[model samples]
Target chain A: MGGLTVNTKLLRQILVGFVRDEVYKVGVRKGVLGLSGGIDSALVAYIAAEALGPENVHAYCMPYRTSNPESEAHARLVAESLGIKFKVIEITPMIDAYFTLTPDADNMRRGNKMARERMTILYDHSAAVGGLVLGTSNKTELLLGYGTLHGDMASALNPIGDIYKSQVWALSEAMGVPSEVIEKKPSADLWAGQTDEQELGFTYREADELLYRMVDQRMSREELVAAGFDAAFIDNVARKVQGSHFKRRLPIIAKVSNRTIDRDFRYARDWGK
Target chain B: MDFTVALAQIKPKLGCLDDNMALAEAAIEKGIAAGADLVVFPELALTGYFLKDLVPEVALRLDSPQMEKLKKLSERISIAIGFVEVSADYRFFNSAVYLEAGEIRHVHRKVYLPTYGLFDEQRYMARGERFRAFDTRFGRIGMLICEDMWHLSAPYILAMDGAMTLICLSSSPGRGVTESEGLGSAAAWQKLTTTTAMFLNCRVFYCNRVGYEDGINFWGGSEAISPSGEMTDRGAILEEDFVLAKVDGGALRRERIFSPMMRDENLAITVKELKRIDREKDC
Candidate 1:
C-alpha cells in the first residue's frame, strides 16, 4: 500500500533475528505460534519455524463450531507446508458448556470468552512444552484497536507487532505461504462471510498506508491529504490510531516515591554485572 | 577569588541546528546574569545526544566557525559545554570543551563508550585513552562524560592525576520510571555522584540533560555534591534551569585530609591487587 516503505524481507529477517536471539538468551528450546488460518498467524508460524526450527515450532489450530471448515483445512495445510507440528482442538464444547452455565451471554461476552479460551489453551500447551507463546497481531491491528485484548494480543514475545498488515502480506509472499492465504479476502473469520475490511470500513492497504505515514513518517493530516489521500480517510485513520493508544502502552501507576518503575528501573534489557 | 559554578540543565532541540545555537546563547546570558564564574551544560548540549547516524553531519570541527561564536560567549564567563568534536582524521569524539578568556583551555574526550541497550556510543565515538586534569583558576578541575563517572577508577584517576574538583557532564535518560521508584535513573545518579565524591574525597559538579529525544527521555537533575557526599544544591527533575553553588576548596581539603582516601597509595594498591587476585582466581 502506497509503495511499501519498509522492506518486508528485511523486516522478517529482523524479527526472526530478534526472536532467535531472545529465545537463545532466555534459554528456551522451542516456541509455539497459533495458526488461526489468518495471514498474520500463518506468517508468524512460518517465521517462528525459521527462527526456532520446524521441529521446535508447534502450531495449534483451535476451532469452534462457528469456525469455517476451510479455515481449519487451510491452517493444517500451512503447518504441513512448513513441516511444523500441528494440533487441532475443538473449542465448541468448551464454549457451549460455559454458555449453558451462564445464559444471556452477549456477543461481546462470547467474543471475550472465545479469546480468553484460545489464550488459555495456548499458554497451557506452552507451559507443558516449555516454549514461549509467539504473538501474531501486526501493527495495523494493534494501532486500530482491532485485536482482542489479552487474547490473541497476549504472548511471551511478539515478532510482528511492528509490521503493518500490508507488510504482513508481503512477508507472507516471501514466506512462501499458499497464494490462497495471501490473495484470499482477509478475515478473522469469527463469523460467516466476515472480512476485516468490511468490518473496519477501510481496506488494509489504505489503513496500512495511512498508518505508516502517520506513525512512522509522522506526517500531518494536511500533508497526508495533499499526498492524495482522502481527507475523511485521514481523519478516520488518525482517530483510530489515537483512540487505540492505550493498547500499546503499559498501565500508568501512580508514583509515591523518589523513583518509579518506568522512570528509574531502567537498566538495559541485557544489563548485568 | 570567590567562585560560583552554574550547571545549566537545558533541553536541546534535536537536529534543529539554528534553534539550538540560539538556545545556547540565551542560556549563556542567563549564566552571566547569575554572576557565575563558570557555567556547565549537559553532554552534547550544543547539537543534542542520542542521534542515530546524524552525529557526523552535526558534529563540529574544533576550530569551526560555530566554535568562534562559543569562544566569543566564553569571554563573558568561563563556559563548559559538551559537543561532538571531529578530529583532523575525521574521527568523532564526545568531547567536553572548556572555554575561558575567549580560548578553549582543555578538551576532554569521553573514554567509556556505552554499547548497551538504547546506547550505541561505541559505534560512533572513538574512546579517549588518556585521562588528564585541567588547571583552572578556580581549582584543579577534571572533566568526564556520563558513563565515565560510573566506574570508580575514573574519579580516583582524575584525583590522583591532580584534580581538586571533578565536573561530569551527562545526558542520562529518564529510564521509564517515576521519581518515587528507588530503582530508576535518578537513584542511580545519586548513588554514582555520592560514591564518586566519597571515593575521590572531592567536590563533584554533575550536570545532566532534560527533555525527550527519540524514545528516551532525559531527566535533568543536576546537583553539586561536597567532599562529604552531601548534596549542597539539587536541580529540579525534567525542567531546564541552572543551579549555582559555591565550592569551599578549604572544606574539600579538610575532608580529604580527614579521610585520606586520595593519599592512601597502599589502599589503592591493595584494591588493584585484590581485583587482579579475583581475576586470577576466575582464571
Candidate 2:
C-alpha cells in the first residue's frame, strides 16, 4: 500500500468518459444521483455533471430529519458549484411512517429502510427526468458489502465502482470536491452517532490494505499474517468479504436451460450500442 | 554509421486488422517521406492492445497478406511493427517484425508477457523462448515488444548479440502522477529507456500509442534516447505523432570508449547465478 497511487487527472478524464458513454450508450443523455455530501457521492455528482452537462445531471439531497445540517449545506454547495438541478427531498415522512407501522424496528432495519427509500425516490425522479440512476458505492464498500442491497447499491451505471474508498478521496481532492466533506469522518448517517469506522471495526486505510492484499494480490491468510497484519483482523476481514460475496453479483437465477438469464444470455452493458 | 528512426505514436482501433493495416500503410508512406531508415510502431499496433477475447480472430501468420503489404512498403523505407503471431499449433504470440527491402529481416516474439496490474498478456499469447539481435542495413538492430524491454536481461541479451539500436514498441497507459514526475508511467519509461541505453551503450527508441479502448487510455509519450542517455525527441501525450531522431553509431562508440560499461559487465557470472537459483528453486 506504500506505493499505491492514482493519476487523478487521468482517472477524472476516464470516469467522465465512462459516465458519458455508459449512459448515452443506453439511449439516455441525462443522469440522476443521490448527493449525500460524502466523498463518494460528491465525486460521482462532479463526474456526472462533467459527463452529461451540468444541465442534464440532476442532484437530489434526500436528508433524514436526524441527518446533519452540514451535510445538506455541503450537498447544496456541490450542486451550486456544478450548477446542476438540485432538490431537497425530505425523507422524514417516509421513514417516520414506516417506523409508525413497525415501532419496534431496530436501527439497522431503519437504516436499511431509509437507504431503500432514498433509492426509490431517486428512481422515481429518474423516470420523471428521463435520466439514468448513477451509483456512488466505491470498491471498498462494495467489497465489504457496507451498502444496503437494492438501496444505495442500486445504479443503472457506476463510474467509480472499481476505485477503492482511499482512491475515492484522491479523486475527490483532484476533482476539487469541497475540502470540508473530504476531511470529515465517514458515516452512513444511518443512526444518530454512527461513524462508519466505529461500526465496521476498522479504518478504511487498514481495510483497503488488507483487501488489496487479499483480493488484488490473492494473498493467503498465512501470507497476510506474515506480512505483519493481525491474524484475527485478517480472519474477520476475510469472513466479511466471503459472507458478502452475494452482494457484489447479480441475483442467482437457478439454471433450467442451456442459456439462462444472467448466464450465457448475458451481454456487455454497451453490447448493442 | 547513423540510422534515422521514426517513432509513430498512433491510436489503433481494437479488433480491426484491416483498418489498422491501412493506418500502418499511411504511416509508412509518411515515414518514407520523412527519409527515415526505420519506422517503429506501438506494441500490437496492427491489432491494438487489450485484445482479451479478440486475440485469436485478429492474429496473423508470418506469411499473412498484411505482412506482404508491409514487406512491399519496406522496399522504400524499413518498417518495424507489432502484431499477433499465430503458430501452426494454434498458439498466439505477441510479436514484432522488422522488414527491409521487401523481406523479413527479424522477428521477435515478446519474451516477457506482463500478467499483473492492468495487463493480462499471458492469458492470450505464448511466451517467446529467447531474445537475440539480427543484422540490418544501418547496423545490427534489436527489437522488443512492450514488457520485454522492462526486464534488463532482454536488452542485455540483445546488446551482447551485437545490437546497436534497440527498438521497443509499447501500448502503456498513462497512470500515477507525482508532483515531480508528472505522468508516472511516462516518467518511469524515460528513466528505463535512458538507463538501459546508457548502461548498454546503445540507442533506444520507445514508441507508445495514444487513445481510449474500453476505458483505458494509452498515453503517447514516444521517445528516442541516444547511447549517452540523451533524449533526441519525445512525442506529445495523448495525441498521434510521428517523430524522427538520428541514432548515431559514432556516439555509441564514443560512450563505450569513455564508460565501457558493456566491457565491465560479467554475463558468465550472472548466467551461473541464474542457473544455480533455477536448480535450487522450482522457478
TM-score per prediction, in order, is: 0.53, 0.78
Cα DockQ of the candidate 2 complex = 0.15
Backbone clash pairs for candidate 2 read: none
Task: Give me candidate 1's TM-score against the actual structure.
Answer: 0.53
**Quality of candidate 1's docking, in CAPRI categories?**
incorrect
Cα lDDT of model 1 by residue, B1-283, tens digit = 4578899998786655566777878888988998888899899888788664667767889899888999999999988899888899999999999898899889999999899877889877888887789888777889989999887778877888888789999999764222133326778889889878887787889999876553245778899999889888989876677888887768786897899877775656767997899999978
lDDT of 2 by residue, B70-123 (tens): 988999998889999999999999999999999999889998999988888897
- Fraction of native Cα contacts kept in each candidate? 0.00, 0.07
Worst 10 residues of 1 chain B by lDDT: B174-183
A1-273, model 2: which lDDT tens digit per residue?
A: 643467677677768877776677567899999999888999999999999999999999999999988889989999998999999999999899879988999988988999999999999999999999999999899999999999999998888887888889899998889899899999898666779999999999999888878887789888999999999999898899889889888889989999887565633233223
In the range A187-254, model 1's lDDT, one tens digit per residue, is: 77677888889999989988887887888778988899888999988888788878878877778879
Please report how far candidate 2 places residue B265 from its true position, in Å.
Answer: 6.9
Error of 1 at B171 (Å): 0.6
